[model samples]
Target: MTAGRTLFVTWYDSNHRSIIPVGRLVHHGGAEGDLFEFRYIQGALEAMERGFQPFIAFPDLCKVYRSSSLFPFFANRVMPTTRPDYLAYLEVLGLDPTEADSVDILARSGGRRETDRIEVVPAPVKDETGGYTTRFLLRGVRYIPGAEDRIARLRFGERLFWMLDAQNESNPSAVALRSADKCLLGYIPDYLVTDIAKLLEHHVSMNVFAEKVNLPPAPLHHRVLCRLEARWPDGFLPFQGEQFQPVGPLTAPPTHADHALQ
Candidate 1:
């Protein structure tokens, strides 16, 4: 469904050592209640060519799967509400358990597990201002200057900003996040760089805020949660390229593959 609640299924390509968005999972809400569908995108084909085996649950490369309930594979990723630390976990993610559903939790927490390379990444939603807004954990925190101390000092809802690092030796298009006085925080995830750069090149009104900062002992990737808001430039579509499309029609490509991390 073409709703704002879309999330991309990203797979960390072990062979290539890079992240690839392999599918689209959309929540199509209606009077009938929750309806969800998942379809492999072009990235899935790319992953297969690069040696990524399909998951045990969804083995087909081109079949469209639908369910009235959240698929078990993803449902299992969220911590159960019955867990003793569930509430505190939500607090760490800056979510209200009363209002946050499974999808919401997955979006903020990234549905990450050490056993798997899969991750759930929320797609940017178009806001009322005709722009888009999304939230993500600040990446590369361990490499930032005084990162933990600066993150510890950040208050709730603190406004953060970014500057283009055209000189970055690793990635010329890297977007560096910083505070008001301009101390480096970290960069947005690499998967988002091109789209973010487009918004900047087109002069979109960009604003980033510190939604929550999980200081110390927390993993570096989860050190800070920031929200970015920007106008969607005309003719701009994120994640709609050929690489995001299926290589062929939905003909059901081997739906019974064994789960292999290799």
Candidate 2:
């Protein structure tokens, strides 16, 4: 048995390689095991207008609530019981066998030129001394100052700047990072607020830095990847598992049946 984990719902536009965050799923320690919640974002609603309906009941904007026991959106990500089935799924996703994280599958799925779609996968949460690190593939690169030039100089495992924007009207828990020269970069995803915001409110020592910098002409949104490292007085427990099992196949179909927009 291990600590529970957090999963994020993201919609990928393969034509542009852009990712739109839709909802989240948090599976914590409880007798119920996996309590699922799904929320629809503004982007999801817009997608719906364009004839995209990923769920039988399209989630309301900015609202959060529990989902059904056998939600296919989550069930498809859980590792299949049989080795052949697991390998076959990976092959369909064009993923390496070792790359088992459902989030990775979701990310890769965006690169295809077919249709934009939604996926549920694990969020990146790493535990360190008295704190933990959360990573984001920085968005809005075009807004940063000479972002392309600066990113060219950044090496692997380099540190960048992180600052919180409490006044951000859209989301109060917004955390932003900048370049070494103090130019604005991008923000931490909205899904991280509940946990990361608590750490900030307690005056926990948090460090923000650059983990990886992918230069252009890569997709504008995913060019620079950043990380937030928070240090608390008490150590935090990170979620353990390469794959998340919320619901098994016995209770649901093999694929995300609800997300298949007609």
Candidate 3:
């Protein structure tokens, strides 16, 4: 991974353990109870405890503000690009999107009571090679539990987002946090996906897993095609793997992964 890519952090209130993002998954969700919030607080506290100052996203949002009480140790500044995606998932949870501001934090900081709210955070924006896509550090990283200090020192991140490619979706965990036993959790906004093309490729990978989600085809940049062609003895072709088996007689277009490490 190159330096200064964007990371998106989102939390879902479910009982599944954190899924590791490797191979094809673009995002990860499926945390349970107050786990998302608690882990976020842990992420923040861990940062401050390490003697580094912390920058905060979602400052206008209550859960983020309340998170401050947990660290009374570090100061936080608002990061303009940090957008959280909890509002969308809250509806799926069958709960009203509660604001951390609506409740009194003095009573809830350590209480860890159900606040009926979810938190979302996005990495600062960057390009495929981890170059800054936006001004400032708005897209540097998503939330990394227990990694504030380490991330602070590194430009890109040693952290990886662990989500199953939707193309490779799997059965939900055996545990039950929802009323019914559910399977196929799709969105948990973790990891820093800087390459839109790579993200599109990951979506393509997800095609093998879930058919319900809408992932569209991506137009490859000419440079990417040239790079792919340069790599092959005959010419560039789609990567063939167990899940991403190609169908057409024609060659496959280059994906984000093809040009990622370049």
The candidate that achieves the highest TM-score relative to the unseen native structure: 1
Q: Who is ahead in TM-score, 1 or 2?
A: 1
Q: What's the C-alpha lDDT at position 231 in model 1?
A: 77
State in Å the error of residue 13, model 1.
Answer: 3.3
Task: Tell me the whole-model lDDT of each prediction, alpha carbons only.
Answer: 0.79, 0.53, 0.23
Backbone atom clashes (below 3 Å) for every candidate = 1, 2, 22
lDDT of 2 by residue, 112-173 (tens): 22233655545655564535766566655676577667677777676677677888755566
TM-score of candidate 1 against the unseen true structure:
0.85
Model 1 — which ten-residue stretch has the worst lDDT?
A: 253-262
Error of 3 at 194 (Å): 12
Weakest 10 consecutive residues, lDDT, candidate 2? 241-250
**Candidate 3, 82-131: lDDT as tens digits:** 33743432222222445432111211111112442222322333247633
Consecutive 10-residue window with the lowest summed lDDT within model 3: 221-230
